[model samples]
Target: MEELSPTAERLVSEFVRTTRRQGAVPSRQVADRTLELLRQLVSEPGWRQTAQLVGQLRAAGRQLAAELPTQPAVGTLVCRLLKMAREEHGAHDEVHEARPHGAPPSQVDSLHRRLTAGRGAAPAADLSSELTGLRANLLAGLDELQTELDASADNIAREALSHIHADDVVLTAGRSATVLAFLRRAARERAFHVLVVEGAPFGGGHRAAAELAALPRRVHVTVIAESALFAMMARVNKVILGVHTVLADGGLRAPVGTQALALAARFHSVPVIVCAPSYKLSPQFHRGDQQEGFLESVSPESVLPYADGALVGRARLTCPLFDYVPPELVTLFVTHTGGTSPWYVYRLLNEYYDQQDHEIVQV
Candidate 1:
């Protein structure tokens, strides 16, 4: 495998840093960036065989997955790239190996000329031609992946009308673009009340409430504190929340207060619906002890910035960026394709990731 150019290295580093600092970028954006990075990776200076390219892609994928183990999209995109390469290689083999996967050299080497002029002057034309076709097809496949990422939000939002009813109260937490888009889509045809839970410390819910209120629709928007979750449950017809990751065990890693919200909804028998892109569906099982490692922790100052330094220094505050919401608490998952039960997530995972790549970290 050839080394990546300086520009590609910088792009990868920037993505890693930005993702760590700002944990709320949409999963679709992350997937798109990952796909673009892979495209650049394959374009590096290398005129290798299809098998060699596939091996390099796998190695690069392992490195990228290590950079951000919690983001499942990185691994999913990598697997898709590998599948494309293998398919192209299979097609080339059927053509009697007459063409190589790499671009053919402008000048073909003759045996007598090769023996006299040395091997460095030219490359085999067949190998070069094959690579040209492989790169083009791989890029086209990447473009298709990007298109899917761009369309996911709208596709998922289209199903809002089917799940939401007129004059119902929809409660949600955090400033999730996915949830906001879903609600706004439904608002176009029906009027309802939306209660945004103030996810304290971050207060993302306040921002979400403000955005929802500003939408040009008759949907009533209300912002409430986390403490008021249970009290307001009776009034909420449904809980439509967004997630950071959906583990294969049918559990969700969501906003810090989402567990409480889901619990309240469960107690009241109100349906709890989760809105997320299919890319966020991870192939790993959720481990409680390891959840903290996967999730980001904000500064303690966000919760007690005004407190005395001495008191703040002496106390340990656990402010995790996300919380676990078990499958049982969730009634349904509304993804880009359509709505389904949480147990059905494994099937989606199978479609997106390879069986061997299920534990990407191990790879």
Candidate 2:
């Protein structure tokens, strides 16, 4: 794959983090909110967020499918919810009078025109320039979130280590919750030495490992087998993981091995923690109580050169890029907002929506 631009990568990473926090399920309110943020990144206003939201929506549909409930409740419920959100937040008829009912980029120019119609717009005032400056300010505010994430990362790491004695090790899943927070605090505390599990096909954990490595603090990376997780428990004192979704009830859907590791950690008296950004924490759950599966596949054609015997009867291979880790296995959720128990995710969602809904105003 071609390398992604830093900005684009950051956007995707943030999305990934958001999805983990929101849980695998997609809800209309959460989707609508996410769409708005993505819109800010593109020129088409809602168009970009619409496209970006599609991935999570599809994932939601798939999760709903997994429950296989004959009742069809998932479709009916979510559709109703989505329709309600659209009616409320989707799009509104513009007030042609233009005192500013809305000023999405698609309509900003028209609004600007209305403000200056037949009036020679101020020669020195550039509407686009003004918009650009405003957008910059908005982006700067969002960028400040990085500092919170940094702090959360270190805090989680420290908390994870709190129950741990020196020389004891910890292993975490692919970006389990609050890894960013732990790293942030870890860097600030001048922490050195971190071992990360490289999640394959994507190896997102490597991103954290790389960031940690760059912190002027010593950090290390080691790839381990999914099968060996339990066996290695003795050396690991804590397990830190990132999450994609945290349900209203506090259940989580993360990478596959996560649940197993959480169980193992509990068995071994190890604390399992999550690091996450605040944008994540939406109270949505996958359709049906069931978790979603990762769509993965291995190339059958790649082994063609080896012949049928070497190919071991010529079976195709498949791989999963993600997994659904349950919330009960987690001990704490480290977020920019603060450390929360799994159940607190619902409360976090309520608070986030309360703030987000009022954040954008016509004025």
Candidate 3:
């Protein structure tokens, strides 16, 4: 397998290290970083052919995935880049296939031959032109991916007013950039109260509440404990949460306390809305037989600080960083494309992630 270019190596290393250390690095950032690394790989001079470049990208993507096995976005971005490469390669092959048998080589084909044979110190004009075009197409695809990443939140947020209303109490758990943006967007048009569940062991809900309160709209924010979810359900009009991954079966992997919130909302017949970008939709199913754990377990110390070995050893603190919320608990999904039902999430998965890359181990 071809090695990653120096620049690609550096970019991947930093991203992997940061993600592993920080934990819960936003999916958007991970997609952007992966695309940036791909852009560099496409432009690197060491590649002899498009196929060679694709092989190297796959190798680099595997390395990135290995560094963070729980991050599906990394693998998703790689699959996208691979698709682009395949498209270009297919087009190039078609052009060659259309050539008349035993005909004189086209100028571009001659240049390719010369470059392959190492007959010149520098590439010919036509070879340079072809390479430039290929690089532009790959870079353009990456740029489009970046734009999609940047705009996903705003696109999803645009549907907020349709779901939220004046005096409605929207309950959510933990810190979700998607949920926060959706609420803030709705708050601009409607006055509402937000009940944030303080997802303990991390207390991310406190930070989420503060950020929501900072919005310019008229909104009331309350930070409540996870234990209080059922108590608050009767007053809540809706539950809006964000997901770490949208499984193929339409279930979600969310911050640890999400399952409780969803269950409570269901008990009270409160609608649960999930805000997610298309990139978070994974093609893999979370069925008992399938492997869909992009979820990670945090340091047990976060649950019970090292008071002493005597106490620490006595208690087995199992703190999973995320919880699985079945699709049955979710009423609707707000995506970049618009609002969809939980069952429709399967379509979004088909749109974003390729079947071939569904298994990260194989991809």
Candidate 4:
């Protein structure tokens, strides 16, 4: 994986290898799983084992777009290419006033004119070939993305947890596993209580609270509304949440109330913590230095009332769906490998992408 294009392939392969060893996935299914995982993995800076594909976008200009989208660097590359095209065209047009008397356009400028001209605006054959290559690379990379994602998740969950003393309130939402982790350690000494929230709409918090409730008597379950969660923040000592996206500026995109929750906790002097697998750590981010998040929604009918004809009625509906919590609000991220802050995530991306720099060439 010495080239930009190969980054996708290498990532898929590495994820497959890791997952297969963990028994999290089968060998036969690894290929297909990795494909879907890489596409998503490259879009965030959460669980990446390598660097942030910073220069991988150059592949598009190198005529590798045909196979670049699915590659680890394709997402970044496509974004870069789009911006590059705009920039290059902007400069070209700015300097494109009628040629000075007797002055001929530069060779490159002449080619540009030819490309823009109707008679030779573009080469259909070349374009067709490039498109085909792009599709091939995309599909190839998608094939391994999923497997990598799941496997990476499982592997990250396997890391041993250090003990956090009792008389502590761990505030967390989403990822039932990480919460269980904190509770498990608490159960060892039987002294900690847990304050959980319902990640409404999807409400992963409901699931989390339930799981913790059944974990013995020491873990207390506090199911609070999105609004009330902030008001009750002073009671907790630690805040742990999940990451939806790791933005470019070393921030995180978590559930909506998470930022509010984190902020409230911060006011009370709480040491917030996040537990996740290392694979969830990625190097891909955009829009300034901050991480971005996409709030997934469910069927609209979910909000419909169950009262007579109410569910099917157009009169009333209730669904706020999901929200993104910025990383600045996060205190520490706990991965199976270890716990670290968002700033450390940047270095992880650098390392991962560095390994993938040359090896990530498009197929």
lDDT of 4: 0.49
lDDT string for model 2 (1-363, tens) is 122334544554565556557643423244344444333343223222332323233333333333322212232323322322322222332432453555553355445656987887534211111122333333343344334434544544665434434444657655543565555554554444455666654566677666666665554556565677778876676776776545556666566566777788888888887765454443445444333323433454442534666665646564443455566677887665557898677656543432222211100
List the candidate numbers ranked by lDDT, top first.
Answer: 3, 1, 4, 2
TM-score of 3: 0.81
lDDT of 1 by residue, 1-363 (tens): 433346556666776787778775667778877877888777765545765566566666666677777676887677777766755664565443554457342122123344766555433223222545788888888898788878888998999999889999999887888898999999999999999888887788889888888888768999888888899999999989888888787888776788888889989999988887867777777776565334667677778774678888778887776777889999999888898798888778655664555655321
* Residue pairs with clashing backbones, model 3: none
List residue ranges in candidate 1 displaced over 4 A. Answer: 1-24, 90-132, 291-295, 361-363
The CA lDDT at 155 in model 3 is 97
Model 3 agreement with the true structure over 100-199: per-residue lDDT tens digits: 6776434444455557665544321121113336777888889998898899999999999999999998888888888888888888888989998888
Q: Better model by lDDT, 2 or 3?
A: 3
- Give stretches of model 2 more than 4 Å off: 1-168, 175-181, 187-193, 201-215, 219-223, 287-317, 354-363
**Candidate 2 lDDT score relative to the true structure:** 0.48
Which is the winner by lDDT between candidate 1 and candidate 2?
1
- Candidate 1 weakest ten by summed lDDT: 103-112
Model 1 TM: 0.81
How would you encode candidate 4's per-residue C-alpha lDDT over 287-309 as one tens digit per residue? 43121123233455544645547
Report, for every candidate in turn, its global Cα lDDT versus the true structure.
0.75, 0.48, 0.76, 0.49
Model 4 TM-score, 2 decimals: 0.52
What is the lDDT, from 0 to 100, of the residue 312 in candidate 3?
A: 95
